[model samples]
Target: MGVSPQQHERESFRADLDGNVRAHALRCAPIAEALSGATRASRIYGIRRFFGYFREAAGAGWVLLGDAGHFKDPAGGRGIGDAFHQAERLADAVGDAIGSDVRLDHAVAEFGRWRYRTYAEYYGLAADLGVAGPIAGIVPRVVRGLHARGRIDGVLNLLSHRASVLDVLTPARVLGATGGHLLRAPGRRHATLGELGRLATTEIRRRNAMRKPVFQSGPAPRPVQQETPEPELSR
Candidate 1:
């Protein structure tokens, strides 16, 4: 159900969903009928952009895990895996604190640091995938080109959450792949160069934006207190 906003006009996309369902129904009649019966209760949930991090992730006796700690767009489909990873990490830290002389606060803080270090690249990748922008166009074309050249395993690994974005898309690897493509297909040299150039420019802009601090003209606002029993940890 998820799609790039840039690739689909809102109304047309919604209209096409019925046709798509019907097409699927043609292949599987029974399922189609069931789906049709369920249509009345079905409601559209529009796509949303979500990428956020808390400046701190642990406080007092509590720490956060999964979406409670960090969240990115659903487009990446990394939530479940990320949750499991975070849970395991938090459990390890808590176990260490309970079993040894280490302070719970210090152990939890270390867990938070590890979580950010491990998932920062994935977060960036998820943001890029979820946002409707030039990267949307660039990524598909790059993947297609790499697929044609039988060199798309890295990208596939990244999408499947089997590899970190940084590991898969390192500068040296990018340059090597682009250079190989240029050498192997002389006709596509210009296009390859252009795509790499655009990608580099986009990355630079993104990094610069990340480096720029948000300016607030007034006094800093107080942190909102949560009413829940468990403290809501942010990271």
Candidate 2:
């Protein structure tokens, strides 16, 4: 996958079930020698972002779950885990509604709130990674520096969705790293700061936009009534 300022491109190949790996080998010749006589097969897919928000998740007796409720870029490979987490929360909400006298609709609303709270930081991180720009260049360097300092575990934990973005990439840590880089490459400091500012501004806009309501709920319309037959006239 390659992210550029204009777009993101993901390319991969798949093999047939009959163990015909020749096509993949031909397409990916760099690894052809290693793939010689390989019997396993695999598939590939592209992940894209369709960022959105829904004001309400419950209406009448129905509720949305998983991707139907929210989705983010798959670049982080957190889709499955996110879906599972949503399902667990939804189940808990449903169970409480069923076991107690609470209204299911209210429980579902609470579920949506919980989902937003849990997914907000990860969503921002995924959005940042999905787009190309200065961040693309700076983030890798930052990670490398963290690794050199033996603090890469924090980054790894963030990638694994085990820690919040702020916890891993705190403002102070980011500033310190940026300062060090600036000192080492004083000539590029201006460009780096410009890009970092743009990235931060973009993220702020995205986060605010996400909070805006994208759905509305109202009472269902009444069913239409049928006209009475003229049976009396026939009689």
Candidate 3:
């Protein structure tokens, strides 16, 4: 994605409500009584959000959580948890810096360096999934890979009511040293929200312009907005 205005807005919206929509869609679906005992369904145009959490070290080794540093798509219900987790990690370092006289600046600088890996992991997952909706192509490979091992096991791992979107997107083997091969074999290894969103939108618009309804079925599914994503049966 070349980063257009509308795409920017869609990404912004996904940070909260829109992200939730994507999260919910990943959930399993149920058969509707009205659908002749069938279960396949599609969810479109719902609010979703993707979240990002971070803190910056202030002067004198003081740290302040940037107000806009946290983001989430209400679609997944994971933002607040992510923010708190970051805060917890930072709190210890902050406390250590304040309570001890052991060269505070050096300790604070070390904290950032040591925490770099964790921060990258958190940010990477959110960045990929946050834009997942707009970049449908990115998901197919990951989702299909999950299918081989039954139920897309790693897609969503919520434990104690905490969501882990990071584990859902990139499996370890695919993301590490082997990732270079993936880049070489592809049409495009990475995708952007703006590009994918515009592609989806343009296709839909073209279909409408041609007066062609994409649905091949006899009728549409009953529109009931659910809190969770459409079930696997629908996919």
Candidate 4:
């Protein structure tokens, strides 16, 4: 929900708070519903949260990788991907540090450049409408034009943990291909689960009622019984 104390102060914290408990948090900068068990559903039904990095960076005086350097909305779920990629890049620098030609300063510079660029793209994408349901008090919903802005693929590879920042561009291309399908679907612009539930509950309830008859049509076929016998002991 990205429902932070800061956001709560600014906008009266209107984000939905309907998630179920998965576990308790130990004061870390940090929900459940019926699951779809599909990739898209998995992305949606889970609660989203993100940590901001600027505060920690200002307080600490060392080079930071990841959201410590920058962060994006957990709505997109790209922060982990972004951090993982940054770590991979850092590992290369570590290797360089171990070699005769190590330049710790150069590695730090490269990391800052890469981190800022990644944050630039990430922040720009997140700022657009339709990315995080609705930004606090900007509007009732995301504008139709920006509804399908979609997740950047380099970003998703970062999310899935399958690729590093060096490999994000390829996935970015694929995300561009079908990312707008839902937005383009008739009346899907600005749609969210709350909007969908309003329209579908009646029909879904009816369907569930219809399913009951089939379920009640006598007992389902019984499983064939099987038993395991004890092994014979040696004489």
Candidate 5:
């Protein structure tokens, strides 16, 4: 039996051939050796591109939680832990509303709002970082500075959700990196300044393009209907 071109492209794994493994020999001896001796064939099993979204959080008596409520690129390893945190907050909100004077719907509605506020910035950052390709723009310079200061652990923690993006990419670090690049040799300085201006404009346009419910994960939410009063029977 033969596989279709599309199927082969999507599923077949050709081992025992030159790929990028040779490129790693100097830095990663184990990977180079594995590539040298590997004889097994298996499918590639990692995400090939980015896919993520946000969805309506609550309606009537229904509540969406975890991936059903929202999902972002898993690159940062935040999904499972985030779900657990959400569950805890949700349990508290629902329990209090049930036992107290607050309406259950109101409690859940507020939870939804809180959820967005808490995660939106991180959502944008994750999407930006998870994009496939070399990391670009000012980030590399900023990372270099962090490395020089022995603070790269903060970046690792940011990815693992133990720290915030702002905590690591502070104004001082960003400015310092930009200033350093701007002070490079004249030819390099000109190129660096142009790139910075271009990236800044792109960033501004991106922010302006963003709208509420930034990404819709599923079907559009159904509109709420108001209850109507029944007319009294004629006397």
Candidate 6:
């Protein structure tokens, strides 16, 4: 449902309106065919593309939930669902610590950390999906292989936020798909090799980001103070 067309920023604001829309729509064959004979209901309008970003979720006396806390590109269609998830968790965190100022501060601070940890991995994937460029990797080949084997649910689940990144696009699957592509189209061996290198580099960056996230904000978890009960007397 999302298309990351590879058009430059300057070209997006060009004077050739119809030419631009047609070229961009034609990036997907089905979309082009569907709109070929379709009539325009209104003059064309454009939306500026948004890159993903994250920020602090909560602080001392207040807490920000949902998109207020963080936001990502809309390519993954996760906005509504993630908003609901954040709202529900924020409500719970508040409910558990409402009676005490100290507890409330600690709870919301922990909530912020929890929020970051929950979406950190998926955040990179969503941003990648929204990047403006041609799909230059084994993704298409692996998708075709999954289709042939009737095992593409993992990809569907991932888009729906029900699965992890490596659930379906494992290293073994990538290797198998790359080998298959070379066997079928040996002439493009060099191109495929280059694509593989890019894929590896992208993964390395993703892992590095995971280890040291650049967008997250919050202090490390502080241990909660608890009243210790006196040791039970022998009975």
Q: How many clashes (backbone atoms < 3 Å, residues ≥3 apart in a chain or on different chains) does model 3 have?
A: 35
Which regions in candidate 4 have their CA more than 4 angstroms from the true location? 1-61, 99-102, 129-235
Q: Which candidate ranks first by lDDT, i.e. highest? A: 6
User: What are the clashing pairs of model 5?
Assistant: none
TM-score of each: 0.62, 0.66, 0.39, 0.36, 0.65, 0.71
Tens digits of per-residue lDDT for model 4, 47-154: 223233321211112367665555444545566766777788767755665443336655666665555544554443443322434442212122222234553443
- Give candidate 6 misplaced runs (Cα > 4 Å): 1-45, 49-51, 216-235
Clashes of each: 1, 0, 35, 4, 0, 0
lDDT by residue (1-235, candidate 3, tens digit) is: 0111244465454455333344344343432223334333454343333223344433354443322333333334455665576577666766756756555666666555544434333444444444533544445555665677785555555321233444454436234313543565555444433444554464455435334212212222322233354333323
Question: Each model's C-alpha lDDT?
Answer: 0.63, 0.62, 0.43, 0.40, 0.64, 0.73
**Candidate 4 RMSD to the real structure:** 21.9
Give the number of the best model, judged by TM-score. Answer: 6
> Residue 83 of model 5: what lDDT?
87
Q: How many clashes show up in model 2?
A: 0
Q: Give the per-residue lDDT digits (tens) of candidate 1, residues 26-80.
A: 5666665665544333433444233355334566677777766666666788889
- Candidate 5 stretches with Cα past 4 Å from truth are 1-50, 99-102, 198-211, 214-235
Rank order by lDDT, top first?
6, 5, 1, 2, 3, 4
TM-score head-to-head 1 vs 5, winner:
5
Task: Provide the global lDDT of candidate 2 against the true structure.
Answer: 0.62
What TM-score does candidate 5 get on C-alpha atoms? 0.65
* Candidate 3 runs further than 4 Å off: 1-55, 66-77, 94-98, 114-116, 132-134, 150-153, 157-235
Worst 10 residues of 4 by lDDT: 17-26
